[model samples]
Target chain A: MNSRKCLAFEIVANPAAVDALCARAETWLIEGGLGTESFPVAMLLRESLNNSMLHGSGGDPTAQIRCHLQRGRKWLKITVEDDGPGFDWATRLECRADIENCHGRGLEIYRLYADAVDFNRRGNRVSLRRRIAEVMTS
Target chain B: MTTVQVQKNDATVTLEGALTVALAQELRPQLQKAVAEGVSSVVFDLGRADVVDSSGIGLLIATHNSLKTKGGRLRVANASPEIMNLFKAMRLDRHFSVEGRQA
Candidate 1:
């Protein structure tokens, strides 16, 4: 039997909202038996949401950010979309951030943690997936 | 929130909760003030912090750069395993000291 759970929600583009949403999603994933996958999942959510709020929406609190999370027995998928003018994601993806730089590491985090990452043509939406770690069974 | 303890040229900054973009923005001035005051060695106590985003990582790198110019250094202590993994993954451990919490 395939046991998969999914959640979708929207939040204003703000730090507090992002925090709350991440916390809620973390709890939901934990309750769904994510085990060791929870931390990286939370990190992925944070980086994506933060990028949407700070860069995509320019920290406009009124901007709406949409998130969708799907947890399957072997994988977890996340998608985040922001209502803002997207950037040239192709070039951005090719460029690497210097270690000393104070910005531009958000994409690096996503790339490191997520097994697969893709951006919409407009660059305002991101979808990523991670293979869920095995959960212990009694 | 954050608390700072200073002793001559060394400072210890204790941070609580997530070190996301908002906290990084709010804490930037205080950290800059420490650098401005000639605090050469700064230790970040993240025992209470559970999460750190890219902005938070950027803040740490910027702080390290600020201190390096003064011949100072930044040390991160008592990071949770997840945070430690992040630092190591970014190769930040090569730039400065990062310690995970003791089991």
Candidate 2:
């Protein structure tokens, strides 16, 4: 969180802003010479942003979700927090596997893209970190 | 999200839309019917499929797994690098045959 080149954007609880946030992050990854990782990064960004917008609203946008993105030496760390009562991460995880499931696929997509995922204080916030480099096997 | 291209011999099930939770419910049955009878193969053209959230992709993957066990095969064609990267991220590219094509 305290790096000379660390940049943060206060993402609004809007699905529209997700695209803009993704474009910004992709630029950074490309400039950082991690261009190959952009696709997964974009997916990760979209999923988390949508989750915050949907969950942070609490069935209501009076509540705002805060998304923080930081660039580490070898990984890009993203933390999304909602100002609401958090739920259990395990229960949500189980829903993603069911094809007939209705919701919570956004977080599941995030888990697929990120190298490591952790839930804090129930599910009010999530911390995700993904490696900047991945080898392509043709 | 569901593209139906009726060919001379069979029909191709091409999907080029968002396959999130909202879309998957309607999509699964469409694919199931495409190859219901004695058709050739259902080529899932993901060329223009932009956002394939985990649920939609999972449905296809699970279908692919099941089809293979029942003497059938699912072929995925025309996936953009961006979309294919999704498969790469989940290490699912190893499970299916992805044919990248031009627009």
Candidate 3:
């Protein structure tokens, strides 16, 4: 085996901080020869981190949200983990049958954006992946 | 949630900020009032919205359905990039004339 070199970032769960994280991720990816995948990866990262901070951490200002970004020549893997109660991805994404009204579709949206999603035992850990081949770079 | 007071003549309806659920109670009256008042178009500004989930997108769809009968049109503007991206991803901007929230 060669090596699974990685880059990780611990980001606070703040809406305002999303833009900067996205910019950094894109910049890093581009400088590493992964430019075209910039926008989708950015979107996936922001949404996942936002969900972790909001739902996973329950808007706890003090709660810590950490993001791990791993990319290689073939794929980019993004993971978001939080220090809070993990939620059930399946149940929450389901529409409420009893209630006539509902709010929030964050998880569903994230699913739509991420190519593949996986959760962990604590439920606080989530991993999403996208193929580098599909992204365009100039 | 933010509240937007839409004044259509005698009818005044309030739309919740980053609308996600379409409560007939608030939306219908406002839309009806706009029609009753001969308002040419009903514009909703989403500039203040930092984020919008699917429920919110549902509300816009519901509003569009309701307004189609009145010969009145619905418009969305001021969508922050956050919301704008969602709209772009879903092609909602094309489905509706979501002008810039120039606000």
Order of models, best TM-score first: 1, 2, 3
Error of 3 at B38 (Å): 11
User: For every model shown, what is its TM-score relative to the native structure?
Assistant: 0.94, 0.62, 0.59
Cα lDDT tens digits, model 2, B1-103, are: 5767756435566776555544555667765665455444556777767666655675667556555555666677888877776666555567667776675
Question: Where's the lowest-lDDT run of ten residues in candidate 1 chain B?
Answer: B1-10
Alpha carbon lDDT at B59, candidate 2: 65
Tens-digit lDDT track for model 3 on A1-138? Answer: 322336677767765465467667878877767776665676678667767766777877567788888876668899989987786866665544221222344554666567788888767888998777744443
Using DockQ as the measure, the top candidate is: 1
lDDT of 2 by residue, A1-138 (tens): 553335477766654465577678778767666677777776776676666666656744445777777776677787878776775777675554433333445666766788888888668788889877543322
Mind giving the per-residue lDDT tens digits that candidate 1 earns over A6-108?
Answer: 8888999988899899988888877777757778888899999988898789867999999999876678899999988875788887677898888888888
Model 1 is docked with a DockQ of 0.85
Query: Which regions of candidate 3 fall more than 4 Å away from where they truly are?
Result: A1-5, A93-104, A134-138, B1-72, B76-103
- For residue A51, what is the lDDT in candidate 2? 65
Candidate 3, clashing residue pairs?
A36-A136, B2-B17, B20-B55, B20-B56, B77-B101, B78-B100, B78-B101
Interface RMSD of each: 0.8, 5.0, 6.6
DockQ of candidate model 2: 0.17
Error of 1 at A134 (Å): 5.1
